[model samples]
Target: MDSNAMATDSTSGPTANETEQDGRVDEHNGPGKVVYEYEDPAYRVFVDTLNYLEPEEIEQVLAAYRFGEKAHQGQTRLSGEPYITHPLAVAGALAEWRMDAPAIIAALLHDVMEDTSVSKAEIAERFGKQVADLVDGLSKLDRIEFQSYQDAQAENFRKMLMAMATDLRIVLIKLADRRHNLQTMAPVRPDKRRRIAHETLEIYAPIATRLGLNNISRQLQDLSFKHIYPMRFRVLTRAVKAVRGNRRELLSKILDGIRSKLQESNIEAGVFGREKSLYSIYHKMVDKHLSFSQVLDIYGFRVIVRDVPTCYLALGALHSRYKPVPGKFKDYIAIPKANGYQSLHTTLIGPYGTPIEIQIRTQSMHHLAEEGIASHWLYKDSEESGADLQVKTHKWLQSLLELQGASGDSSEFLEHVKVDLFPDEVYVFTPKGKILALPRGATVIDFAYAVHTDIGHRCVAARIDHELIPLSAELNNGNQVEIITAPHANPNPAWLNYVKTSRARSKIRQFLKAIQQDSSSALGENMLNQELQALGVVPSEIPAAVWERVIRDSGKKSRREILTDIGLGRSLAAVFARRLVANDEVPQNEVSESKPLVIRGTEGMAVQLAPCCQPIPGDPIVGLLRNGQGLRIHTHACQATRKSRTTEPQNWINVEWEPDPDQCFDVRIRVTAKKVRGLLGRVATGISQAGANIEHVNMDGKKPGLFIDLHFLVQVSGRPHLAALMRSLRRIPDVVRIVREQE
Candidate 1:
């Protein structure tokens, strides 16, 4: 039997209406009532914590305990104890937080459906649908087939998150279940222990912290650290023990000094000392690359006050007594964290010049800080605080729903959720004075997405603090951002390189995928028509039956599908044309060829210029049908295409640029100039004056002389425009030679 629920050996007298059987109390039943006198000590402990609930609710909880106790009768844990102890302990942990009846009931029966003959329908029939739903959500989906362990985990997490979107309490129960399992994992094998510990550290601990359950989060972290790094944990434990003994006197002196200062200021507060958790210390050491001995500020003090205003007074009193470390003070009370955490944090030089961290907050704030969402029932005064945290959590969960809607698969959803788990945040503002909190290193595009999805999709540029900035600019703590949007603007593929938030990335990808499909369909139609025209055939002239036959023969659903395949180079346009025209009796080569396909500069992603050769509009170009990459245009003289042209002649298509393309194309040029102070400035000015824009510039200093080669990637309208810019640059005094680079 588990130690928590072992048979009692006490020598106390029995009470009335209670009888002991095999050192356990017999079940007592009455009219519309359920009771037990001296059941398993663990169940007694769990029941004692439920005094805060109504009498009827408490009876319902006891009924659940009875049901679970019977359901897990034959099951045994790795320790050879009855499995009921595990659920009992999990429920007891939640009861300590004063969770409501349904939560407690769900915690007791969370694993029954997964491990026993119990079903969700039975649970619902016994309890209410709400309780059954909570239990079902807590159960893992391992029974369903998956390709791999990772896929199963991701799908399970995705299912839980969807459940959490409906009710936040599901995760709470699940976290508690995980907590007890980790506590009793000693009997498990070493590899399994490490795997469970790693998952807890990576996913559960961060989640607990994100939900503002600081106390539970710390315990989970420490437990996971102890399992994952046993040797390191022992070393750190010994080190902390030694340090604690040595710092005893210093800690007392600091506490006395803070108490005296607060007393002198007439600030009524409770000041207490706190030690950093082992996991926190270990992470700090690893993150800052600091030795264990060099890690100071390991001990801290917290001042709990009556209200928010008194928190500031307590902070002032402490600062007046000790010199505060510069740039180490943060006032989260004014602007709470995204998790609804609020406290005044400061680091002060202690009696012996050792830094000591301090946090000052109201009593309610302290309660919410430790209990987080559980504070909704843990304390009566924390209702408002719990509601605030709930709002933030609800918003986060809603974003998960949006991510699920936009994500392609479970693994991708998991990737996006992991990206969002970090709590480090930067608070930025909009032009209208509304505040938005985003993850640290978030860019302007993330801010726009946080504002609204439509704004993000249409945003072209942004002005940070009244200065025009690119969409990729990293936002700071108090940046005032004003997004510039245009109706014609759309998300660029390059934005994916710098977008920090998953929402922005997902939205951009979704929009790009849609537009890419449309562009591909149009391009495919054009290519197919061009091929058909060469056979003296028009697509519109084809009968409905013929079109259906072609689509079905190509194993496509519709005409658009076939066209898109052709446009994406997945199917050769010539093959599709030949198939479409197979029924016709036209002789090959009997009809004169039609005009070559025209290349429009506004084809979006359907037409891509070959970057190796940098072919401009005026250059003679041919289309290379790259598999899954649409048309790749290259100059006929390009060296990269020479081998492909000979080996893969069927993939090549004749294409010509429009007479007057509206967009400029990028081309590379080399400028050999005598090294001088003003050489670059003069060349840049000449290029700008000649109506060309330099997109990139590089200098080669390999030559051991006063001359250097400057490589410029400039955008121009055509060959004539590039020549004009070259002539202008040639007039510079330090310019020795200029030649366009083509390869």
Candidate 2:
């Protein structure tokens, strides 16, 4: 049966063996004796979870469960079990993590909106708005049809994350939901299992890690690995078990040694050994190109102390006893990660010359390390600690919202978030000594955006450690960076090449999009004006009703939009003008005596001269009207223009340079000169004297000391100015020949 149909059926009534009582199932014998079954695993787990909550909180959770149970009454899972069991399992996982009553309750009702007829408003009235919002966030929109399964998944993830940003509890509930789903995916189809498992691995697991829920993240990874690569998982699991059996004595010795040393040092601590997860072990093997036997350090130790000071004492004692592996120690306690994980990590040469990793942290730190943002609830009663964590998480969420605002589409937003999910990071400092952690390989542009959007948009250069550096310079740990900004400066498209942060990329893309639209709008206006002139009618003389009709007919919003479409090459200005004048709304008057379209190099991005022939003033030029790209002016002699003229003569329009154009255009010239030390210098000096700037110089020395080919990219006002420069260069004694390079 279809899952949705099963879910709908489940909401009808209780099963044959059960009777409804106060929205719950009560077992009844033939003689009217009522029996409540407490032996079920789901019931037992829920009861166990209640032990961690207060009496009132427990009642609230139970109330939500009863409501959810009634809503999902007749629903059966793919495993043929009652559908309510799924939410109970999710709540059980969250309860295991000691989440607050609201979180647990939300988990129980997370699927109500998706599977049942319950509305968010109803849930809110029964529970609070917070719980309803969390449920709604976890619920999927079944009505929207996406282009592909991948698109649907990406969009769903995007929605979940946006909701998560508002209240982190949504993601906590989502992770719990995913964990339970993966745990019970045995009966699912292979293809479905693989797709869900891959998603769990790629999206959910990384988010769990980023949020610092290590236990959930690790479990998700192993479960995903099992489904995505079952053979490898089985092989690695067996290998780990065999190794554990062989190294039992060695692990015992190492644990005993650490415990003994901590006792001797008068440091009170709890020491235990833990084998790495199968997926992690496999990851290490693949990442390091090692065989199963070669992947050591699979077993690690965790030393939990009473407080921060004692954590250091315990670490020192352990290191003094074991041979420390050089460069394998990290003081995360000194510089906590963005997720607020604080621990000291060290690797040591243990018994049998094997390597073992160790983690040291206080009891509270250990809790935080395991739970991450969820620890906020663990210390919710403490205003200082919980509020600080909440604030940090909220700040990160706010940044995500900013990215969402800047992103052009859902896919782009998801792509940016994926880039932000990378765990590796480098901590850099500002000029004020404030440290800002960024992803590894993040450049100065990413740093600037991390500071502020305006600063990033205006940034032109940077100084790392008091040394001026390029904006693309990769930042390093502890380097103090100072961004140099100009008020009028804007983001360059080239900045996208090296920016590592999503925020930087999004902001740059947004700026470029805005600029493109503005330029296209302006170009569209010009093109339409030229078309109107060609039609022997003035724009002002065209009836407003005709423009309105054209706008309506073209499905554009307004005159400006139509023009922008024309400018962007989405539509032709001539066609639009023909539509406007179809009924002879404006009478023709001797071709309107229109002046030639003027060319000024200062058109910025709105008008571009084709690079093929590099048309300058005094060069015979024609404008090619392109869709979405405005007008592209080309010289008559350009081969590209000649080819396009034959095929698309209608796109061509008359264009001429403005008298005495003020801006310079680039032109290339080739010179063959005697290969000598002063030959290039003399040619450059001659060009400079003729009032032209050499933008580039390419020299070929295949026949050294005999003859050399020189290619110069020089800026000139017009063909006359270029000819003057070429004549000046030709007079040089080392010059054998000089000629303008043609397309």
Candidate 3:
């Protein structure tokens, strides 16, 4: 802590109203001097911290101090102090949290590697791997370039998450670093301060809360609020101050009464008052649309005890002393927060009808609350039970690793990280009592997905505590969710709309894309086979291996790939299919004129159907296999098919869907719809009248409140002719833009 941080405020110190001007002299050219100074006298409190650490630790500390001082020798901070002061302040904050020797040492040297010629290996050798690793894990994301502030902000947030997942302490140091920076943010440019403070409020504070660093979280939230929304923060701050003034005497009486009651009960506890951060109060006002005074429980107290049992005793005593706010009590000791914080919380009407919140925890838990995971290292000796949360916390870290496998691309990996790294969680339970923590707003499907990939793939239904709930039902704290799965079940695309967990969302998307690819590939292969038959090329002659090689050379893999290509019109399936089959003695005959055919088949075959020609069951159909897509079935009379026969005739195929298609195929329909009320309903009614199902409907906005162009992707059996369907659609009143799917 530099043994000088805990300085007291003095009249000799620069007043808050005074400003420090920038000193940009060429200090590096000569002996660099302390470019600026600080007035945060609170740092002086850490002189005692030096007592517990050994002399070797002191060496590391001094080395970092000197190294950072020289590296930033010419640098003046936003507050116009020597840049070393910031690092000193950050180190002091970490010391106050009672972090161990290495963490404190790391804090001292945190920015040295980022801003100076000092090498990472140098820090590693001087300070040990632990401290160096922590420093290395800390981000230099700020020093990178981005297209826009938003882009930079997003990337930085992601980098921060990755860094934290790698080592939780980096973020701890970062929070400390951020707190000190924010404390002196006033000297930063107005815009820069706003951005920094807004980010701190939105993300860092929330992270601290999750970690149970209550004091630090409160300070961060308050500071960020002041900068992000000055008016609101000021208004709430003043209002809270007024309320505190009015309740001071009452709260005093209440605390005394409670203390006396506890003493009478022979229970000794440390009780401290807590005031809600201005940002929290303001957020409640804005989010719930409540007036400033409506935010109750803004004033609270914490009761720290010596043992777990004592915490409960304190809670009972608190309840006995005050009328506890109904439904406001929570026993986190049984169901700890995702970040491993455990406590007993109760809101009560304290003396004089003032609503107050009281939190009760053991001394160990209190340390955890104030110091977070870092306390694991700081006071681990005091917690003799072993690190209970190490495995669970590591599991959380492992799940974050699952995000690392989400995509190979850096940007995409970063995107998925954002989704998986949300610090806030809604802890729920499995039917058999296993706890699962998911992000807030996660649904039953997400819960199902979280249980297992197979469960997600086969999820058919869900029951919350033996009662059926919508798959989209949002699970709450402590919900017991049991997923129901069946072999044939698959995730519906609709799940995408409600799934909150990134894992679930990503899996669903991956599965759907795979399905689309397979379907398109199937259509492509079918067309290719038909084209091969037309060319008198036998499928039996060409070995699948040879065909694989040819397709691979073409940069397409698998029969599915070839089919998908044909369907998409990127490549003719007939050309490739015939080229493969004709590898033997088989010879292709000249092309024969034929109309397109629309065929119903029990098999998956669709006689080289061209979506452009929309060959009907009765039409003379010819197939064109796209590059590696679906087989495009085209009518004999189709202009595109005829053009292919001359320009790319190998695409022509003699093919057919089986005698009866078990399912309807997708067909495009464009309808000019009236803008009047119920017009869309009428259109839907018409499609039903023709015994067709509208699989997809997209409607454009109306221009003059009179009409709209509606595109419907319909599924229909071979029972309807294309010409007849078009005629029926055209006959409908108010139908002007009706067209078959076309170029």
All models: lDDT?
0.85, 0.81, 0.69
Judging by TM-score against the true structure, name the best candidate: 2
Best by lDDT: 1
lDDT score, residue 326, model 2?
97
The regions of model 1 sitting more than 4 angstroms off are 1-34, 37-39, 66-74, 116-118, 468-470, 531-537, 541-566, 570-596, 642-654, 672-691, 705-708, 720-738
Model 3 shows how many backbone clashes?
61
RMSD of each: 6.0, 4.3, 10.6
- Positional deviation of residue 467's Cα in model 3 after best superposition, in angstroms: 3.1
TM-score result, candidate 3: 0.71
Give the worst 10-residue stretch by lDDT in candidate 1.
8-17
Query: What ranges in model 3 sit over 4 Å off?
Result: 1-48, 98-102, 117-132, 141-147, 381-386, 407-427, 476-479, 513-659, 665-716, 720-743
Superposition error at 310 for model 2 (Å): 2.8
Residues 619-728 of candidate 1 have per-residue lDDT tens digits of 89899987789888999999998998999998999999999888888989999999889888889899999999899999987778989999999999998898899888
Model 3 RMSD, rounded to 1 decimal: 10.6
What range of 10 consecutive residues in model 2 has the weakest lDDT sum?
A: 23-32
